[model samples]
Target: MQLPGTTLLVIDDDAAIRERVANSLEESGFNVLQAGLAADGLALLGRQRPDLVLCDLQIADMSGFELLRQITELDPDMPVIVSSAAGSMGDVVEALRLGASDYLIKPADAPVIEHAVRRSLDRASLRLENQRIRERLERVNRELELHLKELKDDQAAGRQVQLNMLPASPWNSGEYRLEHRIIPSLYLSGDFVDYFRVSDTQLGFYLADVSGHGASSAFVTVLLKFMTTRLMYEQRKQDVAGPVAFKPSDVLGHINRSLIACKLGKHVTMLGGVIDEAAQTLTYSIGGHLPLPVLFAEGEARYLQGKGRPVGLFDDASYEDHTIDLPPRFSLTLCSDGVLDCLEGTTLREKEQRLPTRVAEAGGEMRRFMERLGLDPSRPMPDDISVLVLSRNPA
Candidate 1:
C-alpha cells in the first residue's frame, strides 16, 4: 500500500524508461519527480527530500553508483532502488554495495515496480517510528531522574528539621543524665524522643512512635512536639510563681485531643514521664506502648507498670498516671516497638521476657545498654528504632 503524501524521485538517461517508471509510481498514489540526469536527481533530492529514489545504472552526467553513494551520504536512511538494462550480476552487486535498497531490470512490469516501492517505504516508516519511540523513552527517563532528585532533597531537609527538634543527648541536670539515639529506616523517622526542664524542680520526657513510616509519619512527630511543647507553655503561663505542676497523663490526653481535632488519621504509641528532683520520684504514663520501660537499679532490672490506649485514635481514650520512687543509682530504658524486632526472640512475649534481663546485663550504663541491644544508627533497619535512657547517679 502507498504511504500517504509519499514522494518518489526517478532518474534515468533514457526518456522512455524514466517516464514509464515515473508514470507507474504516480499512478500508485505517489507524487513523482523525474530527472534524466544524475545531477538534476541529486539537486531535486536535496530540495524535495523524497521518501524513495528510483535510479538507472547509467546516466548522462554521472554513474548511478556515484549518485547512490551521494544520496546515502545526504541521508543514510533514505531508500533507493537501482534499475539497469544490462541485467549483469556485477552491476547489481555494485548498485547494492553503493546503498541501493533494491534492484530492478529496465523492462520491469508495473506491478513489480509498485511492490518494491511500497516495501521500501514501509521499512523506512518503521525505522522513523522506532527512532521517535526511543527518543520519547529517553526523555521520560530524564524527567524521572529530575523528580527523584527533588524528592531526595525534600527528605534531606525534613531530616534536618527533625534532628534540630531533638533534645541534646547526654544532657545533665543535677544528679540525673538523659541520653537517646534514633535510627530511621528512611531519611526521616516516625519515632521521636524529647526531654526538657519543665521547671527548676521537674524534668519532662517522652518517646513516641507514630503510626506507619516515611514522610507522613515523620510529619506527625513534628505535630507531637508542637502539641507537647505548647501544652507545657500553656500550663506554665497559668501560674508564674511556683514550679509547674502537670501530670504525664495530662500531656498525653492533650495530644490525643489535638490530633483527633486536626483529623490527621494517625495515632501514637508513647511513654511519657515527669521526674521530681525534690521528691525523688518519677510519675509516668503509657499510651498503648510496649514492651514497657525497664528500670535497672542495684544490679537488678524490672519493667514499670503502666497501661493505656494509643493516643489520637478515639475521643474518649483516657490515660492513667503511675508513680514510682526513684533509686539513688539507676537507669531507666525506654524504646519503641521497632526495638522489639531486633530483640532475641521469635515471639513478642519471648522478646518482652528477655528485655529486663538485657538491661541488667548492661549494668545501668546508657552506652553499654545500647550496645547490648545492638542499636547501631549506621546499620540499615526495616523500621524506625529509638532508645531513650534516663539515669540518676551512674553506677
Candidate 2:
C-alpha cells in the first residue's frame, strides 16, 4: 500500500530514463520530482525533502555512490535507492554499505520498478519513525539525570545537619569520662546517643534506637534531641521537683507522655543512665532495649537488668530503676540490637550469650568490636548500631 503525503525524487543524467521513472512513480500515487544531474538532485532534495530518492550509479558528472554519501551527510536518515544497468555485485554491496536503502537494475519492468519504489518508501517511513523515537529517548535521559543530581545534593545537605546535632566527643570531668560511636547504615541513621553534665557531680547519658531506618528513623532522632535538651534546661531552672536528682525513670516517663500527647506514635527502645561520682552510684533505666548493659568490675563482666516497657507503647506505663555501685575502677557499656548479628545463634537467647565475650575483648576500642561483630558502617546494615562506653578513672 502506498502512504499519502510522500514525495519521490528521480535523478539520472539520461533525460528519457528520468521521465520514465517519474511518470511510473506519479502513476502509482506518489509526488515525483526529476533532476538531470547529482547537483540538481541535491538541490531538489533541499527544497522538497523527498521521502525517498532514486539515483543512477553512473551520472555524467558525479558517481551515484558519492552523491549518496553527500545526501546522507546533509540528512543522515534520508533513504536512497541506487540504480545501474551494470549490475556488479561489489557495486551493489558497496552502495548499500554506504547508506543506500536498496539497489535496482536499469531498463527495468513496471512491476520491478513499482515494487522497488514501494519498498524503499516503506523503509524511509520506518527510518523517520525510528529517528523520532531516538530523539525523544535522549531528551528523557537528560531530564532524569538532572533530577537525580538535585536529589543527591539535597540528601548531602540533610546528612550534614544530622551530623551537627551529635554531642562533642571525649566529654570529660572529675565525675566521669564518656565516649560514643554511631555508624549509620544509610545517609541518615535512626540511632542516637547524647551525654550532658546535669551538675558539677552528676553526668547524664542516653542511647536510643528508633523504630525503623532511613529518613523516618532520622526524623525521630531529631525529635529526641529537641525533647532531651528541653528537659535538661527545665531541670536546670528547677522547673520539676523530684525525690532523686536527675532520675532516669522520671525522664523516660516525661518523654513517653509527650510523644503520646503529640500523636507521633513512633516508638523507641532506649537505655539511659545518670552517673554520680560523689555518691559512687549509677542509676539507669531500660525501655525494651537489647544486648543489655555490661558492667566491667573486678575483672568480671555482669549484665544490668531492669523492667520497663518501650516508650510510645502506653501512656500510663511506669519504668523501674536499676542501681549498681560503681567500683573504684569500672567500665559501663551500652549497645543497640545490631550487635545481635555478630552472635552465633538460631534464637534470641543463644545470640544474647555472645555479647559478654565480645564486650570483654572490646577493651577501649569500641569500633573494632563493632567490626568484629560483622557490622559495616560504610555499607548499609540490616539495623542501626550505636554504642556508648563510660569509664571512671581510678581515684
What's the lDDT for all of these models?
Answer: 0.91, 0.82
The most accurate candidate by lDDT is 1
Candidate 2 per-residue C-alpha lDDT over 317-341 given as tens digits, one digit per residue, 9 for 90 to 100: 8987888888888778888887676
Flag clash pairs in model 2: none
RMSD, every candidate, angstroms: 2.8, 3.6
Candidate 2, residue 4: Cα displacement in angstroms equals 3.2
lDDT tens string, model 1, 1-395? 46578899998889988888889878888899999898999999999999999998778889778889999999999999988889999988888888888999879999999999988888888988999999999999999999989999999999999999999998998888999999999888999999999998999999999999999999999999998899999989996966787799999999999989989889999999999998999999999999799999989999999799999998999999999999888899999998888888889999999989988998867788779988888998998999999999854
Best by TM-score: 1
Window of ten residues with lowest summed lDDT in model 2: 236-245
Candidate 2, superposed: residue stretches over 4 Å from native = 13-30, 107-145, 239-245, 253-266, 307-309, 312-318, 363-382
**Cα deviation of 238, candidate 1, in Å:** 1.3
Model 1 regions lying over 4 Å from their true place = 1-3, 83-115
TM-score of 1: 0.89
